[model samples]
Target: MSIKNRLIAMNFFQFFVWGAWLITIANFWFGTKQWEGTQFGLVFGTMGIASLFMPTLTGILADRWINAEKLYGILHILYALVLFYLPQIETPGNFIYVMLLAMCFYMPTIALSNSISYTALKNSSDSDVVKDFPPIRVWGTVGFIAAMWLTNLSGNKATAYQFYIAGIAAILLGLYAFTLPKCKPQHTKAEKSSFAESLGLEAFKLFGTYKMALFFIFSMFLGGALQLTNAYGDVFLDEFKNVPEYADSFVVKYSTIIMSISQVSETLFILAIPFFLKRFGIKQVMLISMVAWVLRFGLFAYGNPTDGLWMIITSCIVYGMAFDFFNISGSLFVETSTNAKIRSSAQGLFMMMTNGFGAVLGSFTSGWAIEKYFTHDGERDWHNIWLSFAAYSLVIAIAFAVLFKHKHNPNDVANVSH
Candidate 1:
């Protein structure tokens, strides 16, 4: 098989492992196990908690001690084992601990996968990562959509069977990773550095750089915006079932699939990243993402399952731009800015800010803010909730425009090389 195809397969299962359960886990937790809503909130928080440290820690290992692919394989296997144990647990408390462990094993591999892909692409004389990667990465979104469909269609969305599908795929992917192109540690004995530097902790010093620090700060804020939709998009749609007039609408019955349109749109937008980055540069591309977030929430604020369904659909479509432009382009920005020696570590820091601290910030603050301000009596005011979120995104976009200092350089497209 060709290298591109191999990487595509890797990306597919990488996200498939996540998609099989992520969107549907709420059903399993609430519908099947009858867990407390407060604890359920913490369940999603596991991703943030795990992302905080595991990705950077594993990135260090990939940079200094182990081959990137090998470490990637190990983490997935460990993740699968924990996932497989999840169905056996009876209590919500136990499930949270198990999920935390599963996240710890799984989150770091996201950065590792990027490291492996970039290294492989750079080594290929025929491949340009900026041009080739988005196409390959688009499959991960496809995989996510495919997994969501399989879970729902197979009647496993509200059952423990969802974990089985994810766990089995994870094990297969773990084994397949061993056969992938080897990504050996770059910092060998020939390179000289101090003990702290030898530990690959130098990646943390990226905070000391003005440009990189501001980029990460904005990334974290955007990450929070991404969580706003993910955390509430479905619930917003599902709540329409509460309205007698709109109870039978397609949006409510097929809320998951409706939300899947975002992922579907992601596949298209991912393929557009190369051109957008070439035309606009990284800062502008991310700024565009911030604006998309504004539209995403604004559309949702007034959308209904009936006459206003277009707004909902449009929000999902806008989601594609809001998500991909920052995530994919931001990674490319990291690739062009950082030294080769700390490539994996730099990716980890990006994930840390966006998925790690950013996710937690979004999840916790949004939940609290919604309850305190958007909820009246016992009912949630989704309109106000979404409006607040839209306002937040607009603020982020304006702040990002004023604060982040960078000039669009066309040569940046070519500079993303080893």
Candidate 2:
């Protein structure tokens, strides 16, 4: 295959492994297993918990010792093994332990895949990586959408079979990873460093700067909002199945397909990012994202599959802006703000705060809130649940606008293109 094809294949399989189960797993827990909400939160919390340390540790090893592709392969193989065991667990508590092990192996590979791709593209003499890479990366979103469709069509969206599907794809990708171009380690013994420094604790030094600290702190707060929708959106829609008038609606019956619209929007929005960041500085772009989040949850608060189809659709559309804007722009911000030496580790730290700490807090807290205030007679009080989320997002948006003080540097925007 050509290099472009290779990258496309890599992107496709990378997300194919995830798409098989990520959105649908809530259904597997709540619908199939009839597990408690808090237990479900624990299951998702494993991703956040693992994100705290696993990615950084793997990044260090990949940087200093193993080829990125080899490490990627090894992790996926291990992830596949763990996933194969997930379906056998009879209780949510035991499943949490198994899923934690799986996520430890799985989450790091997301960063590793990026590393391998950059290395491979740089080595390919014929490729213009900067211009070509985004297109390739978009295919990963396409793969995610495909998996959602498959899960919905196959009726596996609400069953443990989703894990089997993910495991199979992961195993296939693990084998395929061996054939990718080698990404050799860059560090030497002379460069061996302290554990703290290696993990990018240096970025914490930025916290002393008022603006930088506010940015990272708000990033944490917004990150808390990020996973909230993904963790609950499908469940929110699926909840409507109890309503006699809308229970049979295509959306409620096929919630995975409805949710896949968010991924579709994600793909388009990611491509638009370069233009947006260049046109509107980071602050405005991020502010736009916060506003989008308000709408995202607010719409969900009022929408139903029957009378409010447009609102539901609009919420999914806003999701693209809400998600891609923050995540991609935040990454570019990290790239621009930090020094080159610790850039990789700094990015890892950025992810740790958002995906790690923020996600854990969101999952557990949202679960408790839902179990307490949103569940009555086993039916979700979605109206109140969504309104509460909207209120939380509004507060974050207002605070972010008032605080995060970055002067819009037109020159910085121009420099990003180079």
Candidate 3:
């Protein structure tokens, strides 16, 4: 296969491993295991905990000690092993423990995958990373959607079999990674630096600037917004089964498939980033994302499995804009605004803010809020829960607009090396 195709396959299975379970795990937890909502929030928060440090730690290893692909493969293999163990755990505490280990092994690979792909593409004579990488990365979403479909269609959406599907795919992807193009350590022989610098801690200095400080703060807030749906969307639909009228509806049985629409929308939105970034600039694009987030949650607040199904579908479609605009454009903002010396570290800090701190905040707080205000007679008030989320996003959007300031520059797009 050609280099692009190879990278596309790598991206595919990389996320397929995740797609097999990420969105649907809530079902297995709530529907199958009958776990509490607050506890479930902590489960997803494991991603936040893992993201807090693992990526930076692994990046250090990949940058100085090992080939990126090799390290990437090793992590995936370990991840698969941990995932396989999930089927044996019965208690919530044990499940969280096992899941944390799995996340430790898996989350870092997200960044590593990008590193490997970017290096490979840059090394290829015909490849242009800025132009080519987006197309290749889109396949990762396709893989995720495919895995979600497989899980739902096979009647494994609420079973431990989802882990098996994910684990086996991870094992295969891990082995396949060995044959990928080499991405050697770039800083193997770098000048002497402090222990902190060696571990990319120097990126923390970016916080000294007002703009970056505000941006990272908002990133954390927005990061909290991300896990809300992923942690609850599937099971939220599944809960409709309690109503006899909706129990057999496709929305409940095929909820994951419906959720896949968000990923499909993600691919389309990913392609539009450059134009939006060029025309509207980063701040405006980000504001658009914030507004979209409000709509995403607001629509969900009113959506149901039957007559209100369009709201759910529209909410899923709006998810693409709400998600991609902030994530993609935010990455570009980080790429353009930071100095090359600390660019990688800055990127890591960005991830730490969103996936790490933001996720933790979102997971724990939302969980508590749901448990406190949205739960009664052991049933969740998903409508109020969603409206609360919408209100939160609206507040953030207003704060971001009033507080953050950046002049529009077309050159930011030009300099992106497309």
- Tens-digit lDDT track for model 1 on 79-184? 9999989999998888889989999999899899999999999999899998999999999999999998898778887789989999999999999999999999
lDDT of model 3 at residue 221? 92
lDDT of 2: 0.81
Between candidates 2 and 3, which one is better according to TM-score?
3
Task: Give per-residue CA lDDT, model 3, range 160-261, as digits (tens).
Answer: 999999999999999999999988766645578788777656768778999889999999999999988889888888889998999999998788999999
> What's model 3's lDDT at 399?
100
For all candidates in order, the CA lDDT equals 0.89, 0.81, 0.87
Q: Least accurate stretch of 10 residues (summed lDDT) in model 3?
A: 338-347
Compared with the true structure, model 2 gives a TM-score of 0.92
TM-score winner: 1
Which sections of candidate 3 miss by over 4 Å?
188-195, 338-344
Estimated TM-score for each candidate: 0.97, 0.92, 0.95
Query: In every candidate, how many clashes are there?
Result: 0, 0, 0
> For model 1, which pairs clash?
none
Runs off by more than 4 Å, candidate 2: 122-130, 191-211, 339-341, 410-418
